[model samples]
Target: MNKTYDVVIIGGGLLGCTSAYYLCKNTDLNVALIERGMLGMQTSSLAASLVTRGRATRPLIDLCVETFEAVSELEDLLGDKLDFNHVGSMHVAQSVESATAIAKQTEMLRQMGDHPVELTIDQAREKAPWLSIDQADYIVFNPKDGFIDPYRLCAAYMQGAKASGNLDVYQSTEVLELVKDGAKVTTIKTDQGDFVADQIVVAAGPWINTLLQPLGSGAAMAPVRSHYWITATDPLYPVTSPVVILPEAKAYARPEVGGLLFGLRDQVSKWAHPTDLPNSLQGFSFDEDYEGWTALEEAVEPFLEVCPSIGKVDIHHYISGPSGYTPDGKHVIGKAPHLSNVFLASGCCGAGVAISGGVGQSIHDLVTGQTPRIDLTDFAPDRFGDFDPYDEAFLTQCAASRSQKKAG
Candidate 1:
């Protein structure tokens, strides 16, 4: 007889571990977190880990704010240090149009009860003396924004959930299929064996499509690869440099341990899914083709002009990984429409690490038949309209438009 669990969570990235942590903490359910490979070794560990609270939409903004608050106190909750640096963050606008957008964002934030301060270019430069403010017209500063160690945060959740003695975490175990009887999932078939469960939560990140494809849900989840660059630590670089974003360029950077991590939003064509376990330390060969490298350098030029020392810095490394994205660019976080007992928490785009805690909490509420802490109608699995050819074309165009604006 296969061992049965009250709940079996698929994908042990930040989303999965977080869900496990919350379920164990708040419920009496027997939980098992299954990972295809090492825990948090996939997209979660490879994430840029910058935590922020601003977005193009209201639902995401609200979720991000809530998650930022939870992550700020994560160490206290876990009784362990997560190395969360409250260095604050700023979004710089290089043009009048972008500056106007920043102003609108500031107003929206204010309406949301957030304290987003609008700063002139001079004020921004004063706050961060290393920044070049010549071309920048305006900036939006949020003091509560910062970065965290994704690995440490994942470990903290796993450790705490394990200590609860109600959770079983199985790393390197691949879930092969979701066994369902009628509308309820009854068992999770894995490469090693099978485990029965009353409820299944899929927070598989980029690998979500692969797992869901077998169940004919792949079209709803697609993976996009994004890359980031790192620089050797410099004495002149402030450790408190805010998580800076050049919205016009779609580039962002933040201070990290002994160095600075940065990345642009240029995405190449999608590649086939990896068959092996995910590795975070794998380095990309930018030497083969300099398109992405050139783009990153160009985007960083404005900031580098403000700090000449930054241009002289050597490239420490290149980090690349897949981020799950929906056709609509919103997360799919409620129940799978065709399957009642299976819940989805995937397709977080690039914001999973920032909002994993809140996503987990919301999933837990759904499992217990309670209203989610945040409104999830916008992220529902069934919100994509009909999957017809016309709808697909429209979605593709919208996604392209959004990507162009984001990568500009």
Candidate 2:
């Protein structure tokens, strides 16, 4: 590899890979992506690939819509077919509070180009016979929303970036430290070797704080453990079924393989520093709150009402992993605070897959001195100033924000 490049993106998750792809394709600058482990095997691969277009904020909605457009063209760009299921999605509100929230979101979403069809009980049931719409007072359905195979999408971006011939990827290449001179990054010391870059983007998922701290910049997001369960095959639910998000239940479910995949937003929050995590991705020792089963039971009860067969379905796997979340339930994007030629695209806050393409393009536009399509002032890296990840008070806030539904 060359001693230096025009741009060096840290981490090889979905954000890094997409950013690299866009940076390489859009600009004449040389791009190099460095990953500590095999690419697309961390949070990006493990993310619940839910791509819902109905968001509460205008910026989020714009980003999601942009991401959908980018993802729709991935197959042609990479010369590969990705498993992007455009089966649409539904968000049901069972309680009065949730119903009111849904109504407000629906009105705001319409202003942002998302036409959410408010479905009646019978209409919802007709759309999905498996839905127990008896308890749902309101349902907002977005036909444009869907899910994708996150790993495949990540791989496609990597492959597309490589096909550019100007982009280089270094797998299993750990960045030991980032040596900066004054305001700009000058050298990247890695276990394998040392390299240089004029502009650097830190897109590492959970390990973002570690990389930023060396440059006197740190992430305020807290690393929290998130998990989802896969159930045994249920013939009723197919891949074409719409993904259901139950805000009252603090859970969401969709068809996975031949069964259902469901996740819960437990009230209890477990936080940990990424540097303290186990080294191996296959055997990472993070907190897996089995007690979440209590919350999980309550979370899935609504689905049980619609599909009683779900009660009989045995769980196949309880997948658990870490996700960086901010206290205000927003992502941290844009340039790093007090740093030049350094940009940050971390703190996904659990919607990394949905917004990766927009984040990548926004970062590219920022680095190339072009105006970004969406105004990201709300997602400024230093929005909340410096915060300690180990602070219990801050982490407690982050945990609560994990499932705090966003409604403008």
The numbered model that scores best in lDDT is: 2
Instruction: Give the top-scoring candidate (TM-score).
Output: 2
Instruction: Judge candidate 1 at residue 358 and give its lDDT.
Output: 76
Model 2 alpha-carbon drift over 4 Å, by segment: 108-114, 288-308, 403-408
* Candidate 2 lDDT (Cα, 0 to 1): 0.78
Q: Write the per-residue lDDT of candidate 1 for residues 319-358, one digit (tens) a residue.
A: 7666665666677888876677888887677778787777
Question: What residue pairs are clashing in model 2?
Answer: none
CA lDDT, every prediction?
Answer: 0.72, 0.78
Q: Per-residue lDDT tens digits of candidate 2, residues 1-408? A: 636898999999999988987787778898889998888898887777899877767787777777777776777776666867877888888889888877776787787677789888787766555666566778888888889888888888777777764887898999888887788778888888998988899898888877777667866787787778888877666767788887766778788887888777656656776678654456563545453465466456645666676678788877767788888878888888768888888888888889888888888898888988888988888888876656678767877778564321
Give the C-alpha miss distance for residue 294 in model 2, angstroms. 6.4
